[model samples]
Target: MKVLVLGSGGREHALCWKLAQSPLIEKVFCAPGNAGIAEDAECIPISVNDFEALADFAQKEDIAFTIVGPEDPLAKGIVDFFEDRGLKIFGPSAKAAQIEGSKVFAKKIMAKYGIPTASFEIFDDPQKAIEYVEKKGAPIVVKADGLAAGKGVIVCDTVEEAKEAINKIMVEKAFGEAGNRVVIEECLFGEEASFMILTDGKTLFVLPSSQDHKPLLDGDKGPNTGGMGAYSPAPVVTPELEEKIMKTIMEPLIKGLAQEGIPYKGVLYAGLMIVDGEPYVLEFNCRFGDPECQPLMMRIKSDLAEIIMAALEGKLAEKKLELREEAAVCVVMASKGYPGKYEKGKVIKGLEEVGRMPGVKVFHAGTAKKDGEFVTNGGRVLGVTALGKDIPEAIDKAYEAVEKISWEGVHFRRDIGRKAIKHLPPKVLIFAGSKSDLPIIFKTEEVFQEFLVPYRIVVASSYRNPDKVRSLVKNAEEKGIKVLVAGAGLAAHLAGAIASETILPVIGLPLATGTLGGIDALLSTAQMPPGVPVATVTINGSINAAILAIQMLALSDERLQKRLLKYKKQLAEN
Candidate 1:
């Protein structure tokens, strides 16, 4: 199979590199790729937003899949354009991409769905915006509703700063027509983490958590560029916090979009703020983040082509993802005076030397092939990445590799993953076979809460959402699902199905329903084959199922074991 990647940056380079490694992919092509990406795949001169020409090229090259890497083309309806011509593509539609294209649209959706986000309002009139900002006070965020290449947002510390930002964006047109409308929002301050997922509109597969440094200078004390650096497996996004983000932000947003007749069909990136241990939405991106993508692609251990193909074919629910345990860090090298003015045609040196270093990769962003030499061609130039046992080691290796390559006006942040070295959570899954059984089945949630165990309750009928069930079970072990409690009535094939997909311990609760008062259910649950066994409890045994789950989890947790022992003692004393 052949694949085509859109965009000309470090993200595109990383994507092309990963896709080229797939055994299923015979060839890979990148549209207008930089000098670095040309080494990995065939570089075509076709523009990313040129839908007609790109489609023609894809058809000519027999491209099986096209992966979009930047927000500009996606915001321009690139996916819809490709699908209209009967071509397969990844990314969201123009309407759905608005979540990242227009801050006002995203805020409205979040407000409608009760998704946690900052308070704000939209305005086109400059005076009204200024008045609102003045009333709301300082320390607010002023943003351009349209794409500005990451420079459209401004954080103001005073009313004067707010007014100036509005005047520049709305009146002076600092960002061109992009500032025609603006979204003024309350400024949220916290440690920011990036959560990206691949979805088929109905089901989702979460990727490793990463954090990107957006400031142009060190210590985060400068204007925003595309991104300066990034590291994966962010410690701030603990397992419990990740679940909260998924349930509150990602799931609701996807469902709400589908409810509004717009089914999203690609990657959704949620920029989050960890405030007092609670996650809040900072922003959303339609496509993969630049520097962040560089490191994430380095850490992913699965075949990139298979995962993308599954999503395009609506089989994402059945695809399992694997990521390396080792941490990855990417330090971006940029032209001098980035997020402003800078020279671009300086020749870089020592790329081959650094690329040969163990566990290090040099992803080009803005560079051109001048004769036989590679020279800088854009503000953000390269993503220097390295893998290590932890974030600090990765950071050290990344900086060491960065030191080997040099140019006349190269700049980078030395403190890339400095703030992310802190701490991590676990989860249990409860699957109910049918909606009728959900009433008694939901009792498991109360017991889990009393035991202070984190859990997810999902309704996946073997007949209805079989694909969803298969996916949940297939990926359970990697997701840290200690135990799976499956409840059903009649045939009770839910536990059997889960057991077939994963090695995780599965507990079955046969409900007291149907003609035989759950005798038929208990018999079906307990009669699994020798190789696939499910622990069965008594009829209407949701609470006992919860207890069983806790017991299994307590094996690895001293605190939980103590709690369980206390609960058992209390039961005996009563």
Candidate 2:
């Protein structure tokens, strides 16, 4: 089928590339496509903002499917326009697009739908915004109500700064007509993540969580740009937590939009701040996010054409969109002094060399072919992405590629997975309670690498084999173990044995199998003898056991400390 893509950015290019590969697609066309996209699909000259021209082109070309790539067209009701003329389009209607088009509208809908989000107030005047800032105190967030290309929001550290921001947005017209209204929101401190879902206005197909680097500089410093880099399958969003996000954020938003008579279709992007195991909506984007989409598309195992068609045909609920288990990372190469003033027209080199690396893909963002050579055309240039079996491998591959490709003044974060590395080594000292706990403990060890932690798994029957447990516990101290996590079931004595043997912290994980469904083990683990402190997690809590060990290790290691802080911040944001 003929597919028409509406946009001119890197996201649209990637969509066109993916769609062109589908056997079901006979032809792929992109409106005003870039140099990179022109290699894959036919580029049309019609501007994406020209709704009338786009509709006319789709009809004339007999395009069977139209995919809106940018939010501007969706906000202008391009999908609705196409549908009116009996053309199939994959994107939300203008009414549904308000979730991203207007911050005030999104916040209001979130509040009405019982969606968890930071408390916020909308303002059209400068004085009211300043008043809200003064009332809310410093370190709050100020956002322009309409789109400003992801540079519209500011995190003000003081009330004065907030006031100045309000003046700039509402009075000075820093963002032009887009800043006619503003949203003042409570500052939520936590780990921020991007979650996207493909919906047919009813059923939702969730994608892997991704973390985007919004700040222009490393370590999250400097002004926000249009996503300098991104990585997918973020460890921050645990499987359990993803369920909470789907139930709390995605489901409610979809149902809420449908209830309002706008059967939302296409990608619904949620910028979430996870706090204390809860995810709050930081913002919403109607279309796929830039760098985030690059890595997500790389990791998705399902066919893009089929997914979009399913959503447009109102059959998304019956379909299951599969994603690869591998992780993906993308690092952005920017022009000098991005998010402000930056030099352009610099020739980029080593692209072919970097792209040759296994699992590496160089997706051009702000680039153009001038005089027979690729040159930088925008602030953010190329997105160097790679997929791996795990996050570290992905990081290693991505950075390797980043080193090869170069333009003037390209920068990236060095600590992308620095936090995740701590969990790579499991610090648990599993003390097998009798010979019975051996099999289960070994099984737990087999899956230890899945949690990305190193393990010093041991087999020692604490009750019938007290001598072995004592020797193992003594050796554990010499090996510099900060915490002892013992996995034991019924009449669990492994925890007590280890706790009594060493002054280090001990954690007990109860296994479920016997008469009480492991409650007996739980009580045994929890109720340690006086002066012998043992932190007891739930039954089959080996995962928590490893997590606790990592937390304990973070107390002394600065790298681990930062990771723990990030994890805590992510938890708080959710």
Candidate 3:
């Protein structure tokens, strides 16, 4: 029926836009909405943080359901206030909101529940924070214990920098009361993934994983903003990894909150770190993320109003949330010198043209109507999103839309999916006899890394499991791996086993691990049946195995040839 959204940012605007599309929603209203949000829903004049005023307005208007969009109101007990008055609100109580409002509180809960996260120490006294920084060297993370608009965390590379950050946050009050306490945490290196779930304090419904660009500038070389851009279905968060994250991170936090009498509801946003197949919790957000939400809403197949209602009514277990199999990408357009000083109110152009592009939609983040014209009113202006059957297609469509929209000094990363391309079905699989032959395979690894070729390396004992070798070759053929590299030491049957199973090209690497110094292995690998062929490389030569694979992949990819040539040039200089 009637839905009331509380917030005044791009995220709130996107929520309002999605909610308006639901057939279940009869009417929608947004409190102090932006120019873009005004396009779909009625905009009220009450401030988002004004609890009493918002409650009064909701009651007077007989709003059927209210959804809190921002974290501040939730932390201020706005949801509890509404619930106490018998109003239907979708958000967690103030106690549950602490999972995001206070970093120390979250860390303590995670620690108590044995959740995997970076080890950290909390300090309320400025002197104590400085002492911790002095004891722990650089390359650590310093974060404000409370919310600081996503700019409170600093990755310090030196002890001096960490000390300076601590002093600024704790002593100088750079972030005001939000920085009265600080958290110094160990630095964990890995790819970051965002895992969000809809919950009703008991049952959890997971959403697709998204990778967000936190830094303001390209190449990840600038200060953090409220996510410059985000893309969904990130390859790093495979189905296997998502399950692990839910078990290790999300489940514990949800159960922990309930045990503490918070009984959390609505979205639980978990920032995660995937390190070598293991997932660790990085941070928590009380509500949906801004740029991340823009693309996610584009991909979700379920009704927005129904999902919120289910979570609020404790019927999330009975509800089924679905998402499209396609990939979604969102590129944020921001004002020049964003996350810093920048001018606003500049007229924007080509929004309609961009949104009209195939599979593209524009969600306004910061804009206001002046004289019937859209003008920028905040640092991040809009989230241009596109969906496609796959990431490559989505990237192309997203950029197509991006090219149409224009604003002075707007910027985004051109290589958002560069890392993801590696997971694309590998063109080759290289198998070695033993770990001793790793040196030979190292060269192949280097080649694949240099050329950005998708490939995998496996160590197999040919003699120990001849049948397993046959199975491996059979599976490779079934999966369409184009080439194979077989390396062995003595009595090298690796090539023969591969050749006997498949008609695909096989390169043999002879390692000098035997008493005969690889002569037997070399001879055996070089000789093959009349119909079967196995290409042979020099003794202990893994580089040639890589070269052979590259040549096979290059037969179909002309662009890869140019990349290989550049890699060769860089190698020569080194």
Candidate 4:
């Protein structure tokens, strides 16, 4: 059977690539594909949004079946259009796609059906939203109601930031028409996981649980991009948690839609937060997630075309999908200044070298074949995906392949699967504003080494890269880190910033230079914002910072407490 898939990103590429491997599929065609997809399927010049043109081409080519990948076209009722034209397509209908196209619609369905989710209030007015934020306080979540290509949600740390998000989405229209309405909700604390299922309005075939890294930078800090990387199966989603999600979220959702007369079909993606070992729905996507799909495709042991056919032909209950035991990781390579203005058309090299590496597939996202060469055509350029026996090996192999590929202004997150590490949990984290603060970092390291404390040191500027600091704080907590130490010089906001983002004890080590020495930074550290508190140490006090961190950890650790006492006694005697 001949198949047609509509999309132009890494997701579509994976779908096409996998479908082409099916015994039942004789040929595969992608409406609009990137440079990498062209090798797997016949790449047509027609755009995904041009439904009429796509329908005409499908009819002309006698394409046996069609699959829709991206959300925008699906939400616009492309499935309805194709079905009306007597063409079978894979995806939810227009009305059913409101589960992703409109956040308000999805939230109502979840609430009405008793699906577990965060408490939320919808708003169309900017002023009312601002008022709501002011009353609710900080650390709340503000989301644009409609589709925003995964950039609509904002996790605000302050009332001011929440209000600004309200303004950006509702007033300034940051996401175009999609930002006209907003959903403000209480921020749920937990690690986030993505769950995807194949449903034909009844039976559900669950895919491997995966975690998507949204921030553009490593350590979970930076502005939200489409997705930086993803790994499957997510370490946080235990089997128990998966059963709960199936019982509470996925099953009810399909049943509710069926009762509402919306025949839900195709992939249903639940963006979930596993809070206190229970899954809470953050959002839902009508189709597969991009980077998540990349990793999932790499791990699939079953024929992709046959499974989708079962869903389309109402034989989903009889069909089964198998996944390889190996864990897969996908790291997105993007042009610099991505999630914003970026330069394109840079010559990309080293594709052939990467292809020779075992178990690695460079899924192209934003590239164009021009004059026999692939050139960067969009912000996210490629997804370097690899499979391994475990998460760490998969991450290593993915990064190994990622290093082989290059384009002008190419950048990607270095810590793709850092969360899946199981060797040992660090008790403390030491952060520096810059490598210039190494003198202070060395002292901090010396104390940790002497005390036999397991700690990790990172250099990230709170001002230059606030998102990195925020991500570092969040990761520290997840990694079971007890305390944090930050060192900086002038305008030292490092400690204060880290303190505000997390509840863990933070010690500030002030480094001074130039005329005022370190007094300014000392005051900045000592006098943090009214609510955000920082344990400030003296000028160039890296040793004390580490000692203070150990002291905090010692509060709950008798071994550390006794060791700390001995050290203190030795210092006094000396």
Best candidate according to TM-score: 3
Q: What local distance difference test score does each model get? A: 0.89, 0.81, 0.84, 0.89
**Error at 84, model 4, angstroms:** 1.0
| Candidates ranked, most accurate by TM-score first | 3, 2, 4, 1
- lDDT by residue for model 2 (1-574), tens: 7999987777777788778878899999999877777878898989989888988998999998998888888998888898899999988889989999999889989999999999888999899888878877988999999989899999998999899899988999999888999989989988888898888877788877888889877678888889878888877788898999999988988888788877788899999887876898999999899989888888877888988888877888777778888888888888887788888888888987876688887777778888988988888788888898877668767887888877667766665544444334445566666467666666555334433345666767676778877887887766756677788888887788788889889888888868999999999889987899889987887667766777786676554555557667887999
TM-scores, one per candidate: 0.74, 0.76, 0.80, 0.75
RMSD of 3: 5.9
**Per-residue alpha-carbon lDDT of candidate 1 for residues 1-574, written as tens digits (9 for 90 to 100):** 9999999999999999999999999999999898999999999998988999999999998999999998999998999899999999999999999999988889899999999988889999999999998899989999998899999999898999999999999999999989999999888888899999889887888989999999988789888888999999898988899899999999999999999988988889998888888888989998888888999999999999999999988998898889899999999999998879999789999998997899999999999989899999999999999998777568768887999999998899988987664342346788988878889888987777666566777889877789999988888888877899899988788888888888889999998778899998899999999999899999999889999998998898665686688789999999
Using lDDT, rank the candidates from best to worst: 1, 4, 3, 2
Off by over 4 Å in 4: 422-574
lDDT of 3 at 564: 62
Model 3 residue runs over 4 Å out of place are 427-474, 480-574
Summarize candidate 4's per-residue lDDT along 175-258 as a digit string, tens digits: 999988999999999888999999887789999999999999977898988999999988788788889899999999999999
Identify the superior model by TM-score, candidate 1 or candidate 4: 4
Residue 310 accuracy (lDDT) in model 4: 86
lDDT (tens digit, per residue) of candidate 3 on 308-422: 8888778888888788988888888889888888898888888887756877888888899888888999888888888977665576577768888886777666655445556
Cα deviation of 59 in candidate 4 (Å)? 1.7
